[model samples]
Target: MMLPKAAKDPSCGAPKHTGLLREELLVFRHLLGLGENPSQIRLGPPLSNSSLKDILFVSIDVDGPRDFKCAENSPCLVGISILDTRRLQFYMTTISVAAKTRSALGNVENLIKSHQLQVGQSNHLSYRSSKFLFGETRQIKADKVKTYLQRLIKDRFFVLVTYGGGAADCIYLEGLRLGIRPLYHLDVLKVAQFPLQTYYRYSLAKILDALKLPWQDLHIAGNDARFTLHALLMTAVRDWNYRDDKPKSKPTPSTQVTLSSIKTIAKAWRIPDQDQPSLSFLFEDHIIKERVLLNPETRKNGKRLRPEKTPEEKAQRRERKKLAKEKRKLKEARRPQWLFNLGDLLDNE
Candidate 1:
């Protein structure tokens, strides 16, 4: 199918096809089997501190970058997920693109082929997981992705929770600008990384590991989205539970947030929000709290807490100061003791 073509948007890069994941559909069917209504429901606010039932997590994963000005990029695969904020594995609904053939799906065969050495040239994994992993590619693909995403975008779901409102946020907003109406604006969250980077750093595999879910046919957008959702949920849970259960008038959670993505650490990055309308909630307070133990800084209440120093550190400082003072006193007493005694005795006399 001829890929949908749009103007080149420097901000968004080139568009890519969103993969249609059939596994998600099967899961959706399983969800239906449970007799839960599949109707689109507006998500409630994502409670960073609330229980899993109180919060809902939604996320979108686009495989390729697109231009903000135009949709000239080939639409590859975009994966989306709705899940419990507390339990990432409990997926409410996962919607992804499905094509008629695996080849038609942008993120499926092509990705595995690119990693021939890693995944195998004969496509053992790809062949084995073909039927179970991806949905058949669509025969007649749409030219523009805006129309497709318009149907997928839900109200009240937070955006840019993955990349910290970086380029992903830009592409989403640009899609909103040119796509159909019902552009629901919600708060954007910027979660910090964990103190121990390796322990807290998450991926689709890591998320699956945490959930104890089987990790197979991974890397597809839909799978990625699900994993990303769970990963974020795990991070949020860690952040929430790290603090005391008791409600304090003054709370600090940033000390617990330690999530870091490629863009979040960029030294020079100012995200663009051209047509991003106010979704009623300005997220100035939505920033994740991070515990900065080493550097003493002004707190929200204007009181500056001293840098958190360990007992050993304080003791070392005290020892150093005491030794320096003793050294100076000894130097003074060395040669000056006689002269100092002479002056004192003369004055007394």
Candidate 2:
């Protein structure tokens, strides 16, 4: 429903534009292009049929591939990915809520690798900011979940990326409440490559397998997050063709209304728990450091996360790398010979 304009404030007798105020006009919606003609502010494509390009995305997943509705119950592992398609940049962080008796902190190195956060061959910024909360009890864990989540997003615009039938309605709604503009890709894997599917709806494992990602920590909360991103990228890039600014396809009629106010829906989300916690504590901050891939030289727990390379494994890896390099060269060779445009090439990358 369209909001009525400028209701009178009870106290000061002023017009309140955005939301109703019992006392005085506090804030207003700035519909810059609004006019007497309804068409003026309403002219735009609906969301159902949007394409991915130059878009910002935040994909989230729970560890153990658990239902988001169960958040109040068991431990919660929250993986958040920030993807900037325009720059081909991806950043990822995962938070796991375990009992104080169990290992609460996850490996920053493995989390990064499993999540596909480190894009390209090194040199990009490796994000490592970690702090801890004392959530030994169920209630405490729930609060911790919210605490870390708010910190992770930090008010940047994001679309809630996830795998499955729905966007885990509660998490999506919660994110919206947090004022994070959440986007959904609930159909990334719906069109199964085969008919008699054995996988769950929008299964992350199956998607990873299709992408040829060497899977590890399948249901691990942190891994699920990075996998969601890698899977999305793989699907998006396959047989890819690019065009500038494809128009949004109209949203399905049933969903058009729900999505219409998505941007402003957060206005009704619960007020933040508190501006700042009564007490602040820092636990751990995992970082990828300078190396994108697991460095054979770096060791954790007196052992490297990546196994020592055998001669055969090394040979096979080299062969695969060589073939990939040759394919890249072949693709470049097929490009139409043109004057080098550094800016365009760099921008596209």
The candidate that achieves the highest TM-score relative to the unseen native structure: 2
After superposition, candidate 1 runs with Cα above 4 Å error = 1-56, 65-75, 84-144, 154-160, 163-169, 172-192, 195-214, 244-349
lDDT for every model? 0.36, 0.37
Distance (Å) between predicted and true CA of 276, model 1?
47
Task: Kindly provide the TM-score of model 1 when superposed on the true structure, using C-alpha atoms.
Answer: 0.34
Q: How well does candidate 2 score on lDDT at residue 300?
A: 61
Q: Model 2 Cα displacement at 150 (Å)?
A: 2.6
In angstroms, the error of model 2 at 302 is 28
TM-score of each: 0.34, 0.36
215 in model 1: Cα distance from truth in Å? 2.9
Instruction: Give the Å error, residue 100, model 1.
Output: 37
Candidate 2 lDDT tens digits, 1-349? 2221222234544433222211100000111111122223222222222222233455565432245455344434445555443222111111211222112222221222222211112121122111111111122244455555566555544445556643553453463356545432433344222111223343666666654544454553344555555554444322111211222564343223222222111111111235422111112333223434544568665555766788999999999999999999999888876535766888899
| Predicted structure with the largest lDDT when compared to the true one | 2
lDDT of 1 by residue, 1-349 (tens): 1111221333545334221212222222122121122345432333444322233334555444455346434344555554433332121112121212222222222211010101112243334324223244221243444544444443333333343333663565455464333212221122323211222234556544543434455655555554454444344333333322324553333222222110111111112234442221223344444544453345645456667899999999999999999999888867755786798889899
